[model samples]
Target: MQLLPDSWPPARRWVQVALINLVVAALLGALMRYIFLWEVPGVEYRNIMHAHSHGAMLGWVYLVLFTGYVLLAGPARRVYTYLFWATQLTVVAIFVLFALQGYSASSIAATSLHVLLSYVAVALLWPDLRRRLAGTVALPYLLAGLGSIVLSTLGLWALGIIMSSKPPNMTLFYLAIQFFLHGQLNGWFMFGTLGLVVAYFEKQQLPLNRPRLRQAFILLLCSLLPTYGLAVAWAERHPAIYAVTALGVLLQLLGVVQWLRAVWPALQQLTARLAPLLRGLWAFGIGSLAFKALVHAAVAVPYVAVMSFTVRNFVIGFVHLVTLGATTLTLLALLHGQGLLSLRGRVARLGAWLLLAGFVLTEMLLFLQGLMLWLDWSFIPSYHTVLLLATLLLPAGALLLALRAARAPASTDPGAQPLPQYAAHSPVSANGSADTAANR
Candidate 1:
C-alpha cells in the first residue's frame, strides 16, 4: 500500500483542524441549548452563538476549502505545514480560553494572535499562486479571493482592537458584522467556490474564452457592490447610500442571471453524469438569487424587518448549500476521479444519496424558517430542534461519504486530473516532466 506522503502533511493537518472545529461547534451549540432551553445560567446565548458561528464558518468550512485549494495548487510541503500548525494552535487557544473563562483581555490577546497567524497562512499562498498562474483562467478569481481575505482579516483585527478599548456601540457592532459577512460570503465563499468551478471546467477541457472570463469577473464584482454599499451605509448611516446599495444588489441579481445563462449549456452536458450533485448546485444558486432579491426588497422598504431573516437564510442556507454541499460534492467527485473513491460499488451511490437527502432536508428547514419569519409568525420550539437534528445528520452523511472515499485506492492513470482547464500541463513523469497531454 502506498502511504500518504509526508510532503502533503498540511492537507491532512487541515482535515484534522476541520474535524476539531466541527466538534467544537457542535459542543458549543449543545451548550447553548442546555443553557437556554434547559435553564442553565451564566452561559450567554449570544456568546455561544458567536463561538458556534466562528468555529463552523471560519474553522470548518473555510478550512476545508483551504485544504482543497492547497491540494489542487500542489502541496506546500514544509512552509504550509508550519503555517497550518501555528494557525491551528492559535485558533484552539483562543476558542478554549473563550469557552472556559468567557471573553476577557487574554481572550482578546489570543484573538489577535489568531488573526496574525491566519494572515500569515493566507500570505504564504501568494508565492505558490504566483508560480501556478500560467494558462489558468481561474487564477485571477482565486487571487482576488485571497486579497479579500487579507482585507477581511485586517477589518476583523481592527474591530477587535476597537472593541477591546471601548464600550459596545450598536453601530460599530453592526458595521463589524457587515464587514465579516461580506468578507466571508462574497469574498471567500463565492469567490473561492467559483474559482474552483473555473478550475474544474478547465480540467475538464471546457472552453473558456476571454468574454466568458470577463463575465465571470463582472459577476464577482457585481456581487460585491451591494455588500460594499451596505457596509458604507451601516457605518455612515446614509439613507441615499442604502438606496444605492439596493440598486447595486439588483444589478448583482442580473449578473447572476447572466452567469447562469453562460454556464447553462455546460451544466446541461454535466447533468447526465452529475445529475443529483449538479441539481443541488442549481438549487443553491437559485436560492441565493432569491435571497438577493428579498434583501433588495427589504432594503427598499425600511418598514420590513424581514431583511435580517432573508440575509441570515442566504448566509446560512444558500451559502452552505453551495459551499458545504456543492463544493464538497465536487471535491469528492474529483477525488473519485483520482480513484480515491471506488466507483465499482453500490455503497458509493448510497452514500451520495444519503448526502443529497441530508442537503435537501436541511435546506427545507431553512426555507420553512424563512417563511415563518417573513409571515411574522413565531417559530415553534420543535422547529429549532428539527433544524439542529437535520444539521447533525447532514454532516454525519458527509462524514460517511468522506470515509468511503478515503478508503479507496488512488488513481494511477497518468492523465487523471481535476478538470481539463485546471490541469496546467500533462501529468509529470518521475523526472518531473510532462508525460502526455491527454484529455479528460
Candidate 2:
C-alpha cells in the first residue's frame, strides 16, 4: 500500500516536516511551562524560550507559509525545493543552538542566514508570482506579505547594531525585537495566510465580493504600517505615538469588518458543507482573527496598552492568540480542507480537538491572570501547576497530528491533487454543500 497517494500536493514533504517542527516546538513550550512548576535542572528558561519561539516561528509557521506559496506557484521549482531544505536545516541549527547556548554568535549567524534565505526566495520567486498572480485577488496580499517579510529584517539589522553598541542599548534592542515580532505576526503571517485562503477561493471558482476585498486589503495594508506603534507605545510612552497607533487600530477594526463582508458570503456557503471537524477548525481560526482585531483595538487605550506590555501573562497570551489561535488553526483547517491531512479518523479528531482545547484553556488562564494582576485581584491558586498540566496537551496533540500525517494515504482530493488536476474534481453540489461522496 502506498503511504501517500500519487495525487498529493507537491508540498507534501514540506507539510510533513512542518508538522514535526510543530511537535518539537510544542514540546519545548510544555517543557518551559513545566519548569515554572517544578525544578527542572539544566534547563534554562530563557534558552528554552528562545528555542521554542524560533522553532514555532521559522520551523512551523514559516514553512507552512512556504508550502502555501509552493501550492500557489503551480509547477514545482527546483529552487523552491532547495530553499525548503536549506531553510529547514537552518531552522534546526537555530533551535538547537539556542537551546544549548541562548543567542550565541553561532545561533545569531544561523538566524541571519534564515533571513538571507528568505530574501533570496523573494528574489527568485518574484517573477513567477508576478506572472501567475497578476490578475488574481491573492496577488496584492501575497506580494505585500513578501514585502513585509523583507521589511521585518530591518528590525533584525537594527538589533545587531544596537547589541554591538558601546553600552549595548537595551531599550533599542527590545524595541527592535518587538518590531520584528509585530511585522511577522501582523504583517507576513496574517497577509500570507489570507493570500493563500483567497487563492483557494479563486481556484475553486467561489463567489467573492471582489471590490470589497480590494477595499479591505487597502485598509489593512495602510493600517499595518503604523500599528508598530502599538508594540512600542509602552516603551516610548509618547502621546503622539499612542494617538497614531489608536488610528491604526480603528482602521484595522474597519478593515476586519470589510474583510468579513468580502468573504462571509462564500464562507457561509462553503462552511456548512465542510466536514464537522474542519468546520470547527474554521470557526476557531476565523473567530480568532476577529478576536485578535478586537484585542488590538483594546490596546489602543493607553492604559490597556501599557498594561499589556508590562504584564508578562498578557504578552504571552496575546502572542499565543495570534500564533496558535489564528495562524496555526487556519493552517490546519486549510490542510484538512485540501485533503492533505484527513480528519476522518478518531486519532485525527482527538489530536485536533486536544490542540484546540489546550490553546483555549491556556489562553483563558493567561488572560485571566493578566486581568487579576491588573485589578489587584488574588492570583489563581496553583496557577503554574495548572498551566503546566494544560500545556502538556499541546505536545500530546501535536504528536498525534504528526503521526497521522506520516501515515496519510494517497487520495484524489484537491489537497492530494496537483493544482492543474483540481478542475477534474466536482466537489460542490447545487445546494452549496460539498459532494461528500465524490470528495471522500
Candidate 3:
C-alpha cells in the first residue's frame, strides 16, 4: 500500500523481498555444499558461510518479523518505512561484505548497524504496541521477545571484549557466541513467532484455552534464561550447569506440552478448512517445534550433551531443526494463512513441496551421519554428493517461491476466501491496499 512514502515499496513488496532473500541465502548454502564435494576456486568456505548465516538470520527471518509487525500493527509511521529500508540496506551490506571478507571491519560494522537499527525500531514501536495489545495474549511474548533481543546484545558485546583480549580466552569466546546464538534463536525467534501466532488467533477469533495458554507462557518464559545454560554446557560441563540446564529443559518440555494442549484443538479445526498444502505445513510446523523440545530434552543427558557438542554434524542438524524446521516452516504457514503467499499458484505449491522434501532429506542425512559417528561407524558412502543434491532442492524451491511471489498479483485468487473474522479484523485488503477505516 501507499501507507509509506511513494519512493518506498508497498507492504506486499516487503514480503516478496523477504522471500527473495531466503532464495539467495539458500543458494549460498547450496554453493557451500557444492564446495564440500568439489573444491571451488576463489570461494572461501568460512567467508561464504558468514554470508549465508547472516543473510538467513537478518534478511529472511528478521525482515519477515518486521513485516508482520508493520502489517498487523495497522497504519505505521513514516519512521517505520525509513527504518525498514535502512535495515534492509544494512542486511545486504552484511551479506555482500561477509561473502567477500568474512568478518572484516566493514562486515562487522554492518552487522553492528543492523543491531542498532533493531534497537531504534524497538524504541519507537514497543510502547505503542504495548498500549495497543494491552490485556491481549500476544503482548507478554512480544515483550519478552524484544527484551531477549536486547539481552542477546550483551553477549555480542561480551564476545567483542573477549576477542579483543590479548591471547583471547578461547573458552569464553565460544561461550559468548553460544550465549548470543541461544538468545537470538531460542529466545527472540521462538518467542516472537509464538506471539505472532497468538495475535493471529486473536485476529481470526479462533478458540483458545486461555488458562492453558497462560500456563505455557509462564513456563516458557521462566525457562528462557536458564536455558542458556543448556547452550553453554558444552563449553563448561560442571554439575551446577547441568543441574540448571536440566531444570530448564524440564520447564521447556512442560511448556511445549501445555502449548500443544492449548492450541491443537483450534488448530485442528482451522487446518481442516485449508487446502492440503497449507494443512500439511501447519501440522509440520507445530510438530517440528514439539520435536525440537524433545531434542533439547535429550541434550540434558550428560552423554548426549557430550556427543552432540563434540560432533559438528550434530550441532548443524540441531540448528537446522530450529531454523528451517520450526521457524521457517511456521513463518511460511503464517504467510500462506495471511494471503501473503499464494499457494493456489502451481509454482508456489511445487516450491513448498520441494522445500519441505529438501529439509526432511537433509536433516535425515545430517543426524544419520552424526549417529554413525557417535556409534564409531564408518561414514555414509558419497555423503557429500548426496548432501549436495539434497541442498540443491532448497535453493530451487526458494527460487520458485520468490519468482511466484514477484509475478503473482497480491491476493487475487478468486477461489480463496477469508474466514468471517479475518474480514472483520484484517488491517489490509487483498489487493496490497491498507483499509484505513478497518485499521483505525
lDDT tens readout by residue for model 2, 273-385? 76666777788888888999999888788988888788899889989999998899988887776555656577877999899889899999999999999899988999998
lDDT of 3: 0.79
Tell me the whole-model lDDT of each prediction, alpha carbons only: 0.57, 0.81, 0.79
lDDT of candidate 3 over 1-440, digit per residue (tens): 22222222355577788888899899999999989878999989999998998899889988888776665454346887888889999989988999999977789889889999989877875886776677777778777777888888788789778878999998898888788788888888888888887777765657888888889999998888888886678777899998898889889999989988988877877787777777777777788889888988887787887887889898888888888888888888877666566667889889998898899899999999999999999999999999999988998988888877733334445223221121124344444456443431
User: Can you write out model 1's per-residue Cα lDDT over 1-440, one digit (the tens) per residue?
Assistant: 01123223344445645656655765575565456346556666766776666666667666666765665556635766666666667667666667655557776677677667667767776667666655576777777777777776666765776676657676776677667767776677666766666666555545455466657577656657564665666456577776777676666666555555655565555544544543554455444444544554455454432254344654466455555454555444544443334333455556556556656676777767776777788885687677666666555654555454433332443223422222244444322334344323
Residue 174 of model 1 has an lDDT of 66
Model 1 score (lDDT)? 0.57
As for lDDT, the candidate ahead, 1 or 2, is 2
Residue 39 alpha-carbon offset, candidate 2, angstroms = 1.9
Model 1 Cα shift for residue 72 (angstroms): 4.2
TM-score of each predicted structure versus truth? 0.78, 0.92, 0.92
Sorting all predicted structures by TM-score, with the top scorer first, yields 2, 3, 1
Model 2, CA-based lDDT: 0.81
TM-score of 1: 0.78
TM-score of 3: 0.92
